[model samples]
Target: MASIANKVYLFDRDKNLQWTSSIDNLEDVAISADGNKIIAVASNKVYSLLVDAPEEKFHFPVGYPDAEWYEHESPNGQGWMTYNPEPPCYGYHLGDDWNAKPPPDYDDYGDPVYAVASGMVVYAKTVPGDVWWGNVIMIRHDNINGTGVITSMYAHLRDINVSEGNVVGSGQVIGTIGKGYDDKLPSHLHFEIRYGDSETVGIGCIDSELVSGEQGPQGQIDPTWFINTY
Candidate 1:
């Protein structure tokens, strides 16, 4: 539970330092509404780390089969470059507006987005709009005590496969990644988990007292409780 700053770090369950290094700038630190799980966003990839997995080593540059876009700048300001940081492959970072003329295809957005765990759908939105987050969904899960309970969320969906009031099982397909509501950024899913009611979901407002408060509509839970870190 150390403050999530710009660096990527590893720690033991006792909060002892295990390893540390600089990834891309840390965008956000999402803890499952429960207190046991965490997902940190660094540039294009999401790193899921669990407090339960304190003894194992975790590294970035997820070894996916394909290389995604990443930004890098020249030392002398010649220009920005786009490259795959994945080893054995040499890619460069493209400038900020590199894809302004020809953007990535819709199909570039990948397949089925799944539920992190079994839960009840408390909120789901499918229509297009101007919000920073496009289509979004929120679910509530009952976790064991000590971690309290949690609420899971998925956003920026191209398609919503589930509806409000629906009960879903773990790994259920809920949506697909799509363009941001602004149509500027590429297709990506803005997934999150909070520990309170549906209204507090995805608002980026982390509130304490969720565990002790009356389970109201705006409470929050950390997101780390459900994600499996490997």
Candidate 2:
């Protein structure tokens, strides 16, 4: 699979022009089954458009921070994660274990955190004791079209800038990378694009897994899709 940073070709069979998009330096990638619907993260928000749909079809809002804190029942106690999927070149700590404490250069955290997609700040918290995910923010992206999309989460932040209910623009700055609370690894952002609702999603910073219920999903969606579209 291609890393999120590489540019991909989008062929609009019905349309004449072939559009090209790059995912380099972007946050996430979203694509419809046939490669028609496209959404990609630029800075703090996502940009999206359907081949047959008008510009109004682009639904992601600008800025918003996390309002409430999420406490999941985990066997290892409460923890959070960062999802920086820029391939093995950037942000990715491939052989590095999530449970290992970051080296001295990254003791405090590294890299400023940006929003994956624009939306309202619905949940934010900076509790001291979290082991895997330190400071966290979860924004709810509005998908009014009922395309089956909702909030996206930015976890393990070193600092959060906005509060709850605030509206932010696409590609806005929300936070910075901090020492992860639970993972205890390098400072990086954990990004998750939630479909339908929360409570069910993937896990781990690297070796990303699709977590649905007690079991993880079978395959990983090409991160390239979400990173390229925005």
Candidate 3:
């Protein structure tokens, strides 16, 4: 099957058009392993069609389901988004910078960072002398809503509570916020959601065309939007 513009086309082994479905704003399409279903991503939502239906699937990184948190523009207390993923001179940010809501400074230092969803911890360690990423943890989530594998990264952590191969549950405590190895930036958590490769610890930023608003280049997406959507 192939998706073009606002439609999805189904073809047989001879490459002849079998059928087509009109799905507005279609972005991607995939056939299930048994060829009994079709999964389509459109307008930031997942559609599961019965090869005949369609359907859909954030817990949050710092708090539980009922925890009150804000992003970049919080008017309430101790947490807000400090920086959004955007293309800067250094390259695309590739993640969101979340800090305590108020009193600023290092007040949020040592605060616990939770896993946004259940997944296997792929990387959990500090890169010696790397000031940008103090202690970091990466979790690989597989077959999410039939969207395939995606990796969540937490950086500038003060403490790492999980190992490289441990399977963590959603909202599990994994680390604490920190001020990077060099103590240059204030206390905050640099969170990222990477698509495709789950093992590589990317440079955190890259030079490429921006997509879907402030979303970084390929391999990275808007973390806040992703959490709110999925």
Output the number of the lDDT-best candidate. Answer: 3
Q: Rank all candidate structures by their TM-score, best first, as comma-separated numbers.
A: 3, 2, 1
Model 3 local distance difference test score: 0.66
Worst 10 residues of 1 by lDDT: 58-67
Q: Candidate 3 residues 116-161, lDDT tens each?
A: 7655677999866666777889987666656587788898888999
Off by over 4 Å in 3: 1-57, 73-89, 103-106, 213-218
RMSD of each: 17.7, 14.7, 12.9
Q: What is the Cα root-mean-square deviation between model 3 and the actual structure?
A: 12.9
Q: Any idea what lDDT model 1 has?
A: 0.46
Candidate 3's displacement at residue 108, Å, is 0.8
Candidate 3, residue 1: the lDDT equals 72
Q: Model 1: runs farther than 4 Å from truth? A: 1-110, 126-129, 144-146, 201-226
lDDT (Cα, tens digit) per residue for candidate 1, span 117-211: 54566678853444656677776655423334566666656787877666554455677666656554455454454554453333432232234
lDDT of each: 0.46, 0.45, 0.66
Better of 2 and 3 by lDDT: 3
- TM-score per candidate, chains pooled: 0.44, 0.44, 0.64
